[model samples]
Target: MKRILILIMALVGLTVMMSGCSSQETVDVTADKIILVGTQNDYPPFAYADENNELTGYDIEVVKEIDKRLDGYTFEFVATPWDSMFLALESNKIQAIADQVAKTTEREERYLFTDESYFAAETVIVVKSGRTDIQTIEDLEGKNVGALAGDSYTLLLEEHNTKVDNDIILKYSESGNPAEILQDVQNGRVDAYVNDPIMINEVIGKLGLDLEVVGQALVNDDMGIVFKKDTQGEELKGLIDPILKQLKEDGTLVELSKKWTGGEYIPE
Candidate 1:
């Protein structure tokens, strides 16, 4: 009887151990169901806070639509500053970025971009409303040009400046305040700035600023979601690319662009 009781106790212990292991496995699977996305809430018509302080914009809506189409995974957005977004992604704090991120050769080396671009816009030179002297990028010679410190547009401007023998004085701003930047231009603190034409127009309209874009497009850039260059990122790109392509084909992408920009901004 003693031996039988001992055997029964051993079996009970084994069962408990197995049950604990099973519970741990279930918990791991549950954790895998949540996907965190990062975005800057300061970019208007792309990812900005509404009057009620809810995040809503073209990029936010696009990600929401993607979440609806994909199954078995839930998305949670982490409002991160633009400058630190890539760092957060690289550290695995966020799975992807849904900001109006443009794909550039330098970024492509460090990150994986979505196969299908969700939006496109022309890069233009923005100056004070009455400024006719600085019309083209070439016209920025020896003038102070404002650019976000770590933005792709800044990189492009810097590259152009270097090509032109550093003719333009590059003024870097950490603050992502369009009003302040435009004010600087209006007050002669910065001679000009470079950004997407759509964004320039949006900011001017929203703030009642006296800024205007002058010159033909310097470059046309396609914007897409960005992910860290890793196995998980590759897998996510594979899953998202097909859905994005379908959305573009079915006119949903164009509709969203119109909803945000009041017209289709997708490249032809």
Candidate 2:
């Protein structure tokens, strides 16, 4: 009888040790966990610095909301230039990007995009006020056009130029400055510029620039958070996708779009 009692006590102690080990492992995994999100601070109404120099914008707020819903995970924003944003992501400096990144075929092959899109935009041509002569892609022939280097707008212009037998003078801007591009158009340096219509309107209003959007929207794009194509990225996407769908269904995404763009830009 004494031997039986000793074996039972030994089993109880072994079970307690195993339980302690499992609890410690869980705690170690969750402790100090954080998600690094990248964004461009210059992109207003989407992601930008406010008067207090703190990062606050539509994208910034949306990420904050996600962080709140996710337990044991924190999101830290890393402001970067648009040109270098992808480089930073590829290097694992950031876990994801919340900038208004459009999902394109070429980019899809390299990165994993979230299943839910946070915003949508239409590309438009911007010219100096009173320049109604140039209104469409056909009018850009034999004219100087400017666009940010490595952007979809630049790709569209290049494709159009080729279709027209290279009649357009493409001025690729590497500075990533919307104001500089607008100034070039105002000074007659470039005949026109191309970018997202929502962004163009916000920049013109915020800076009080004398520019007007002309021509119909050239392309429609949906924007989503971007992640690296890897195991870690896949895990993060799995965690956020369901939450994003819930937000969309509950009308939170539409509310954010209206607050930032002054209209319901979220697609049905």
Candidate 3:
């Protein structure tokens, strides 16, 4: 009886040891889902918080489709401040940024980009609707220009037209997003604000804001996803490429853009 009891105890210990080992070795690559963060809540059509406070918009839908492609992986949405979105990525607080981060030489130095451009837009000066006096890009030369500090647009405004020797001093107002910039412009707090043309149109249409695009879109740019400044860049590249390609091929991107933006912001 002693021998039999000892044998049973030994078998139970073996089973427990094997079970623990198996559990430890279980690699859950799929369960290790990627986190996509954004700060364009007020930039609408790209990203924004609806009345319900849910993050919903063009960029939100695009990232959701990207999530669908990675069957094993899931996505968690976090609303990050615009200025801190990249910082969040750098700190690994978020795995990726799905905001309407435009491609820029300065940004390229610190980040990797996905090939797919959800939309092509240009920078434009937004002013109150009746302001015909500020009719062109030239009109903005000496005027106080407003843009979010530390944003891609600010860099574009600073570096693009260096030919002019300090023609306009960008009055970096530290607004949270483009909409706030427009609100300041309308309220006469700022002379003018710069932002994506599509976004300006969307905000005007949605809120019926008395804002108009005063000049032609400047600084042509492709909107895309951004990843950390690391060799693991290809991880996001590999995951999103196949999915975005499929979406483009099936006209899904256009459809989604329309659904979110009320029009084909991603023009055919």
Candidate 4:
């Protein structure tokens, strides 16, 4: 009876010790950061205003999910024109942009991109259906090619124009609405246009616009959230990068891609 009592006492003491040690364990607590995320309200299936005039799209929802996962970060989207996004970042009006932002040499110098990319943007030459005269960007030399101002596709067109003597005529809309550009193409206003294949496919099907992908991807680039090259940008990128990896691993990205874009647009 004495030996059994001693064993029971020892076990009770150990349990109490462990309970005290666990109670002393500190949790990682942090102040919440209000991240003013910049985005475009015109690009459909990515970020845009619905008929209700409320902002809701794939990129927007992704940020929302991130906000939920981030214990100390609150993401608030600030909508603006696609071209004006960088300006907002430069002016400190927004901390980062979560649009389907592709990288360029100039952008790399000016902004910091997340280590992981969320979207694989395959830019292709878009033309009217049943058109065999044009096959690639080079084939459109001396022809009118429509592209949004300040988009990566326009950058590619501009680069090609510099290499060749006969530059492709570039038509642009201040609105940068893909449907308007597609209608322009259908009405014979412009010979061709260039944009992301998934976005082009989405807009074409929704509006019943008569356009087709002319060739394989002119350029394949991964889209990352962009921020001004500064301390806050660096810190925010660090916080978001791991969560982005988690989302990809957990198949959240595939779900969002299929839901909004109607297919898997994520990078393999």
Candidate 1 CA-lDDT value: 0.85
Candidate 1 per-residue C-alpha lDDT over 1-268 given as tens digits, one digit per residue, 9 for 90 to 100: 9999999999999999999999999877844367899987777878888899888899999999998998877788888888789999999999999988888998998899997999997788888888779887778878899878667778888888768775788887767665567778877889898887777788788888788899898888898899989898998999999989888989999999999988887754
Candidate rank order under TM-score:
1, 2, 4, 3
TM-score of every model versus the real structure:
0.86, 0.86, 0.84, 0.85
Better TM-score candidate (2, 3): 2
- Can you write out model 4's per-residue Cα lDDT over 142-260, one digit (the tens) per residue? 99987788888888888988999999998877776777887889889999988887777878888898889987778899999898888888888998999999989999999998999
Query: Which candidate has the highest lDDT of all?
Result: 4
Clashing pairs in 1: none
TM-score of model 1 vs. true structure: 0.86
lDDT of 4 at 202: 75
Which residue window of length 10 is worst by lDDT in model 2? 159-168
The lDDT for every candidate, in the order shown, is: 0.85, 0.85, 0.76, 0.86
RMSD of 1: 4.0
Candidate 2 lDDT over 134-158, as tens digits, reads: 9988888889988776677787887
Candidate with more favorable, higher lDDT: 2 or 4: 4
Better of 1 and 3 by lDDT: 1
Rank list by lDDT: 4, 2, 1, 3
* Candidate 3 global CA lDDT score: 0.76
